[model samples]
Target: MTRLIKYAFLMSAAIALTACNETLEDIAPKAERQLPSRVVQTMKAKGMSKTSPVMMRIFKEEGKLEVWKAKQNGRYDVIASYDICKWSGQLGPKFTEGDRQAPEGFYTVRPGQMNPKSSYYLAFNIGFPNAYDQANGRTGKHLMVHGACSSAGCYSMTDEQISEIYAFARDSFKGGQREFQVQAFPFRMTAENMARYRNDPNYDFWKMLKVGYDHFELTKVPPKVDVCGKRYVFNSEPANGGKFSPAASCPPMSQPESLLTAYKQHQAKYDFAFNAALKKQSSSKQSETIAGHSEARLVADWSKRRARGEKVSRLPPNIPSPTAVAEAPEAAPTPAVAATASAYTAEPASRLQTALEAVAGEQQEETTTAATETPAAGTVPSPAPRPNTSPERTASVPAPEAGSQGTSLRRRIQNLFSR
Candidate 1:
């Protein structure tokens, strides 16, 4: 009976051990459910589609939008290009939201403005007049990319194309921009990116802005913006479509300064450059001519160009090589003095004379010291000084003024006393 009890205990202990092992196994991820361990596996899961993604590229130079078909692993082929808006006002930063002006900063394309059947034609909301604007105390609303060649302050793509673009963005968002990069730039920020402008009474504000622009320039990521004291702290976090909120400390936009002012400032420069280019083109027959001058001749030339189907643009000439540019020859180094010159020989003799003089002076000083030590000529030595001759204390003496005789007298006295 005791043996039977022992066997039963052994069996119970074995079963408990097995149960613990099974519990651990259950907690571990199953081999089938594990995330793919390789990039290829992830790629396979995210299937590639042949259908081109709709993309919009805004050219600030022409104030137009270039609709593109961004095929996977393919170049962005232009479907159509259309002038959407003109520079409405000044070129300054949008200080507050709801300024009724389009923003120049890089913003992500998001959902919320995809409408197929709208009265003003097909449109997509730019998600503008955003919270930043409202927080900054800006007013205005309903900024959309709509149809009709008119705008209060919105990009108006053609009615037919906007629908296609909208559909494409919707689908692509569902897909991804790794297949496309739909981007928009403002008033050709390229050259204007360099053009000069005065510190908009809000120079400091723009400096803060430059922080955000610099980040975007480097990372190509829209900066996470934070606002304090009506100034922007760009790249503060919430740097993309994520579950992040603007900081609670963000102050309200009491600044009456128009965000459009930044645009207006920027526009002046762009308009200047653009108009200058236009004027140059109009005035100069030096512009490239394909065997024609008159408007009729140009039209005929254009028709010939169309027949040949050659693309034409008034692009600037290629920059010249460094070698092509003339540079002044470097001046020869000032001629070095010849070692055989008398100046060099005299230099050593003078140095030797100085050394000999120094030695002679030292000898003379020694002789004078000896003379003082031995006692003045013809003077008898005083009776042998007392053995314990301690000097009497004197009242404190002020230091001698700089370069005073007191200093020289002190040195002479010290020498005599030493002697």
Candidate 2:
């Protein structure tokens, strides 16, 4: 009986230990059941295996997630590219909590970071607030790439897409890769695009990101990433086998001479092309401004006349009826139109339209107020003039008599037209 009890206790303890040691996939089994056949086929096509190493790259602007797998030839080949269903925030790195900005940087995901029982289907944390982020004093948490097609500040893909991406990471981990890298970028770091946004506040940061981007582009290998001097440095070694510290001054470092030469040549070629593209973009913009100037002046004159209650020959054709404009299918931009469009499309047009509408609304409101307040013709009374409530209009319209709210409103409308 004593021997029997001891054996039973030992068995129970062994079982418990094994259960505790079970992996995420072992416990969840979803990836095991659904991913094996597809993963095997994909690996076979890529000349890889289930255990092959993997890396991911995400482009928020283009909404793409690409997975690359190591092949027998020791080169990484793109195994799959998934369309991101949705991602939150604008074209910059997340700075603080609740910023809703999906992070843009190099991250590493380890086995423990995988969440098989995620509310957003299977998910993996992208390891935000990395060394570079930390060095810069940026803060955020729980940034993930997951399924659900919705996000606050995460990269959300369809359930099917996440399944495959999750499987790739899982297999890589099982194949003895302890971690995989994820490179997130605002957009493709193309020279033409960079040149167009050169004046933007984020240009310097984007330029930094392009260093890593260029490294990968040149070598087709994942760059060795480290942080020093509060910025990311890639593919460099300390001058004499020294260790790197993220927040400290960068020690003298060296890169392969061949790589240095290749990078310089690449930069020279792109710089020339970028300058050419910039000249074209600038010339196009100047022509557009010149063409629009006359129309803008006409619109301003019309707005002033309408504000004064003067009869106008016609309204601007571009100023569509609110309902018609709302219902109209936006005309598909032709190639010519697209070529001339701003790098950030439709922004200038949208802003101008919004300002115009606001001015028109204010003028209408003032006109109604004036008509209601006009006293009986015979009554002579002086009331102190109302101040112009709209300060934005003051720039274009001269101040009228104290009580001339209608004139003030009209002036504001004219100002918007000028804009």
For all candidates, the clash counts are 17, 2
lDDT by residue for model 1 (137-213), tens: 65555566677546656666665445445555655556554333334454433433433322245344444555555
Give candidate 1 misplaced runs (Cα > 4 Å): 1-62, 66-82, 85-87, 93-100, 103-109, 176-186, 190-194, 199-213, 220-419
Residue 238 in model 2: lDDT: 91
- What value of lDDT does candidate 2 attain over all alpha carbons? 0.79
Per-model C-alpha lDDT, please? 0.45, 0.79
lDDT for each residue of candidate 2 in 1-419, tens digit (9 for 90 to 100): 99999999867876776789953444455655346576579779879987889999999888999999899887788888889999999988989988999999999999999998899988999999899998888999999999989899999999888988998998899889999999999889998889878988889999999999999888878889999988889999999777789999999999999999999999999899999989999999996785457444544454454445544334433332322222333433234323332232334466456555666675666669878888888998678576545554445567555777667656655554555
TM-score of 2: 0.65
Lowest summed lDDT across 10 adjacent residues in model 1 is found at: 313-322
Per-model TM-score versus the true fold? 0.36, 0.65
Worst 10 residues of 2 by lDDT: 319-328
Error at 266, model 2, angstroms: 1.0
